[model samples]
Target: MNYFFSHFHVYRSSNMILLLFLLVLHQQHYFIKPIYAYSRVEDLAINCGTESNSIVLANKRIWIGDATNSKHFSVLESSPQKNQSSISVATPHRDDPYGTSRISHYEFTYSIHGVTPGHKFIKLHFNPASYPNFHPSKSVFSVKAGPYTLLRDFNASGAAQEHRDHHHHSDPNKILLIEYQHCIKVEPGQNLTLTFIPNTTHKDSYAFVNGIEVMSLFKYHDQCNKQKKSRFRFSEVVHHEESCMNCSPSAQPPPSQTKPASISGGVLYCVIAVSVFISMSSIFLLCIWVWRNSRMKHKAKMELIYEETTNSRKSSITLASGNSCRCFSIIEISAATINFDDIFVVGVGGFGKVYKGYIDDGTKPIAIKRFIPENGVQGVQEFKNEVEMLSQLSHPHLVPLIGYCNDEDDMIIVYDFMANGTLRDHLYGTCNTPLSWKQRLKICIGAGLGLEYLHSGAKFKIIHRDVKTSNILLDEEWVAKVSDFGLSKIGPNGESKFHVSTEVKGSLGYLDPEYSKTKRLTHKSDVYSFGVVLLEVLCGRAPLLRKVEGPKRCLVEWARSCQSEGPHAIDQMVDPFIRGKIVQECLSKFVEMALNCVVHEGNQRPSMGQVVEGLELALQLQLKSED
Candidate 1:
């Protein structure tokens, strides 16, 4: 069966004739083929040193080996190394796919453009022999083509079957040429990107590609798409009459004699056509009515989202993924927030001011962070990202997004109010509570769990690029829940790259130095920032203090220096408020773990899973000291 996808708009010239042609075509199952023309096939070759319009390396590409002479798929730069793989492939030219080898530590992307939108095929060529030290399992990687994930934690070596065990067909001389195919739909004005990212779940992970090729698929499918079919269906009746000449007179059709196309029968044909049009119109309206009724039933109201009464806080409501979130009107949010009163204001940050609002006689209070008008479109996008991430990710350690409001100048997100507020407050902000050793341990552990879950527990790994003490909140029961996913990005194995390699954006002193220098983001970047937060918890100094002089102003640097001086010197780095409360054994390990995280290199830092384990041990030691 041939499918003809037509443009929704039809021709206005010869309107009646065009309608008649379409009617006949629809009845006869005919197709109107589009004129086919396509650009020549283009090949992208990467040498890893130079920037060709077509090649993608980690950060830069090599110029000497580029052979394709076509636009190169661009990617971030990696350290250039000589070819030393065990298997060798024949190279015909400088722009050939097998030219030079470039490697990436985490993830990178290649942008392909300069062509029309439609189905385009990409062939990714890989040379796994470049990684001799790591086993096949450690070589898992992924590739994303637009919204489609072409590969996921794919094992190139095993899938290639070059290391076959004692097989007759297996020849040692045969080189394993691993290539992947993907057909992507690139829309108008949108450049297609093929991202290569290492799998984070595996150990000794890295991504590498020797070559890539991009080609237009237009001409390949043109033969079938350009086939034209005849539109006339009027001849079968005329042929039937001749064949029926030998039959009896009683079987002679009187309607055929009258002929429906005759002028006398025009009124009857008009009535039949009008009746068919009315029937179609009625069916269309019925479908619309049913769709509207379904939406009305699925959507919930703001009050119904989570019920609150004068007696007690309402039961926490969990929404099914399909549930339509409550869309609050401006009047309702204003009433709940007391007309955006300053008295209700709880916190203020880069995005906007957050106000604590209550419903049903203050029984259930919620935190409302409204966008500042100055933020413009960026504020709206952040609000959208937060709502999207928070709704998809639901954990006890994560602050739940209760609802949101978008009306007039407002773009606000309502979260489950953390009565105790930010962890940064207890350590350094206005609250300044002298939190006991156990309480501090609990808060840090909770935050670590949140980060750990984000890295591996949720449906997708999330890189909370802005992981700082201020983003960690304490609920009424003092359970720490990580809040604010505005800067969070889906991590490795996503349709995008494994790690989001973008501009180095995060709070000062909390930003990862490696990420800042290379602009390559990973889950470890969050670990580096969390290490700074850990230092804040231990020493109670801000990440960057303007008053302090020299390196002492940076808390992590100061703590690292004290930590190198051994146990006696670490005592001085402990927060004076909780100095005597910390156990000697606990302090040593805690400081060591935090220092381990702050190390200049990202790979050296432990994952949040390991961080949680270390913090738990420290907490246990602190309890023993109390005993």
Candidate 2:
């Protein structure tokens, strides 16, 4: 029982010790304070005698010694207790005014392990070695004259290893001896302070701590962009302002010495130079492209306009048998209508509206019939045909043709204006002011003369293919003038009656039954259509009245029934307002002319010339009866 208790006690003690060691290590790792390391260089002072030797001594250089010199260097590491371990020192070299030697450099390291972190204090000492021929100087040598520091919270093993490498590599006679006695203790969250002295401009020699070669702070440029090439410069040292605690965050810290002092200025110069070159090149190419394009476009536009004007001028000539037509522009028509105001509106047609306008040089107003052609392909040909035929033909009762204008899209014909409007308007409109028998006879005679001219008087006997009350216009004195030559055709022969085979064309009510059947045209075709208009003038009703049903209500059928039913039916056939106002002999003669024109057989119908003669004699007889 005693042995078992002894072994148990030993085991418990061992475990407690292990536990205590682990706790100590844990506290050191988690709660130890930090210290920042730094290095610097300084100058030392020495004195000589009052003679010239004093000046020489004042100018004398001081340096770390070679291997043969008896100045040893070392570092000490320990806790707050009096225990210490020596670290090795490295060789140094004599300082020369013009030579930067490699041997004078040395480094020392020490770890502040197990030391409390606070404002730690350090002491450094130096022992000067005397030469056999030299005397002691008034000034004492100080190791603190060079860069020195005290550190806490560092790796003790690492510091010791670095010190060993530095000494082992150095020559034995060149080791400098150093003496120091100081202690520092720190706890957590404390900082270690280090102080250093530096050489001034007056010093002949300087000292520095051996450490890693750090890059110097780079100089910043402040020259304007334009002055970079000519105004930039560099100096040996650069100056900057540091904050009391830390470098100001807003301030731009100095750059490392990896780049040369002139690097920024050179980069800016190269960029500016390249940018100017590129800008000049781009401008030159752009100018050339624009110039070429402008020249080419100008040439093309001029060519197009020239071609259009040439084609228009060529089309102006009247052709006797070709389909080419000349057209006037909308601008010219706009000018003619004075911008299509209400005042210039003369009449309306099936396709488009008409307006009365005068040419630029003329005072007489001309009726301009404007229409979009149903068959656009044949529009220009039809326009030229009408202009050529109308300009060449002249007759007293025909609507006289004036000059025309040609522009790209619009085609217009100018004609002498009729002040009294169309016969359809007069016979059917509210202005039903009953025409005197004398005026009716005259209107019939004038209209018959216009048809006679179209049938025989023109250089080429033409066919007034479309003849209706609307196609006839009146002058201020009520002189009937044949108009609307859109469907009119010139005889194939110049002066003889020629039948030009064509498609069926004529107004519905006045269309010749024989022509609509056989599609053949002759002069008597005009006579059949005229017969319809004559009946409309005599009676105020249209030839085909929608009021009656079936095909027999036509004026010709009703007029034919008049003769069979006798003169009493004739009185009803005429307008009631103009009944009995017309003389019996004149009415009979006028009805005879109309009957002869509308004969079913084209060969049996009287010519327009013959109709004109009959209408004139009837007009004279009616005038006599009125007197």
Candidate 3:
């Protein structure tokens, strides 16, 4: 009886403790608060988080304001891994109304690449959250100079809200409002990308202007711009005519006006018929003359421009596929580069430099790569191998070869120009704008898909010997397109491995140590390079880090050490700016995939197909949680 009583008491006590904890948790969660502003509509004040409160500048910090008290306001831009210091603005007076507060006029500085002079002012009045009657017929922001001038604001508040919260349509705090304006340029083709968070508002808010959305192709005809302008002019004429009619005196038939009405109508009809005939005839004649002149002039001008462009663009290739491949005349290549001006140079590599050039009457822009030629048949073998292999493969991720131009003086391979540049530039600051988290995730997935396609989807086995961030080019949508096939290897039919005992060639930090020593290249070698790139994505560190102790500091070595050290070890390895956002499961799987790719033995490493699968899984997991 004593033992039974003791056991029953203990069980009852545990149940009571759990019940008490549950009640406390329920109460705390149920009473959770939301932001509220009780001030009159006219009393509210709003401001942008920019230096000098000017919306014309690049760096906009953070948007923050208070409804009631004149408290110190703060905004912070911190490293991803560490807590950021607050940038506070002290209130001059404590007891001031919302609109009358000194917070109405403010200035601050935020640094991206450097400290740029800019401003953040309250350009508009009203908040989307509190002010239910907020509506603006028109809003405009002016630029200092250049082709971009004034931008007309458009409605972007709806899509902004819908997309931000996984289409749940329940997020009250999400700001769906987007202000927009038109972009102007002098190029033949107009390239525009409008990117905004889904769910909020505004259809006119473009993604490209904010540097958040990028894309690849803009295939507009040269005459399209002129045609569009003409259409706009025609529409303006019609609108003006309608507006004028409304303002004009009414033309009513009076009691004595019958005699003149028939004569006036007849005159007007005759005049309209004559004007139409003359206008049509003149337009036809002008079109014919312009076409003839442009065609004749274009042929001669194009040849001359091609000659000058190709000379400067085509750098000398040391290794030639002489006799084994077709070679063009030096004059032909010279016509492609327009005398190799500095503006044509796109990138430079150890073997040679790449240039942007237009060929075939300036209708196409091709990537002209000049490489060092080799002395023997191996050079010919490599060139033939790359071309033959590439011809057989077709995928959206891989760069397609239009053709190759090889002269005795220079060699050039043509590929479609990737407008958004490289993955390296996007992540680590290229041209100016830094990539957002959303862009980075999209880039990773695209790159993985490309690798997956090459490893398994391709007709024959093709290995991307140089798989680094630099090799990954981004399209307009920030989609990753892998390039650089100079060092690629093709496998024999039905045979996965074609044992090629050749000298190892690849980027320094990305080279597989085992392959380097053994001189046996395989698909696993490409896998190893991919692992280094994965590390870069996770840690935001360069493939090669300086070793304080010796010259042996590789990213893989450091990652291996971190794994055994502790969970925080990987934390230390992560890029400081983005540490908080790194999902643990995703990080773990990424690390695991990378390590599998970097195994001591080639056979042990996971294939590129598997690596891509793991990365996709990791990406899906991250997206689901963030949603």
The candidate maximizing lDDT is 1
How many Å off is the CA of 387 in candidate 2? 1.2
lDDT per residue, candidate 3, 1-627, as tens digits? 564456456556656865897899999877863222122111112232223321213333222342212232322222233322222232211111111111111111111111112211112221112221222221111122123222223222332432332223343433333322121233333222111111124422211111111111111111111111100000000111112454546665556735555878999998787667556555655665687799999787756655654554444333333323334454544556544543356677765678765556556656677654421233444454555556566678887666666555345566776766677765442212446655666677678778777766876667778899999987655678888776787643335545566778888889988889988877778888888887777776567744334322577888888887878888888766677686788778778887788878988988777877887887777778788
lDDT for position 64 in model 2: 34
lDDT of 1 at 282: 55
**1-627 per-residue lDDT for model 1 (tens digits):** 011112111222234555786799897654553223234354444443233334336534433233234344445332344332212233222333444344555566666657567656566666444344545557678878778777777665654552232122244444445555445666778777777778878776766666665656433322111111101000001111113454776875566544347665787888677567555555655665687787776553323322222111222234447745666777767766657755356788999899866654444567899987556445555677787788888788999878887665567888887877788777753313457778988999999999999999988889999998889999867899999998888877745664677877889999999999998899999999999989988887678866557867778878877767777778887888888778788987898899889999998999999999999999999888767
> What lDDT score is found at residue 18 in candidate 2?
59
Order by lDDT, highest first: 1, 2, 3
Q: Worst 10-residue stretch by lDDT in candidate 2?
A: 215-224
CA-only RMSD, every prediction: 25.3, 52.1, 31.8
lDDT assessment of candidate 1 = 0.67
- Over the stretch 1-627, how does candidate 2's per-residue lDDT look in tens digits? 564456456556656865897899999977774321112121221111011111124545343321122222222222233322211132122222101111111221222223232323233323232322222131111133113323222222233233334223233344332223232333366423222222233222212222111111101101101111111011111112333865679777777867564978898998787667556555655665697799999888767655654454465656445333334566655655655544345566654567766554434456787654433434455566667777766677788776566554456776777877677766643222456667777887888898888777777788888889888888777888888777888755634635677888788789999988887788878899999888888876677755566643688888888878899988888877788888899989998898888889888998888888998989888878767
Q: Tell me the lDDT of model 2 at 162.
A: 34
Q: After superposition, how far is residue 90 of candidate 3 from its true place, in Å?
A: 38
What lDDT is obtained when candidate 3 is compared to the true structure? 0.52
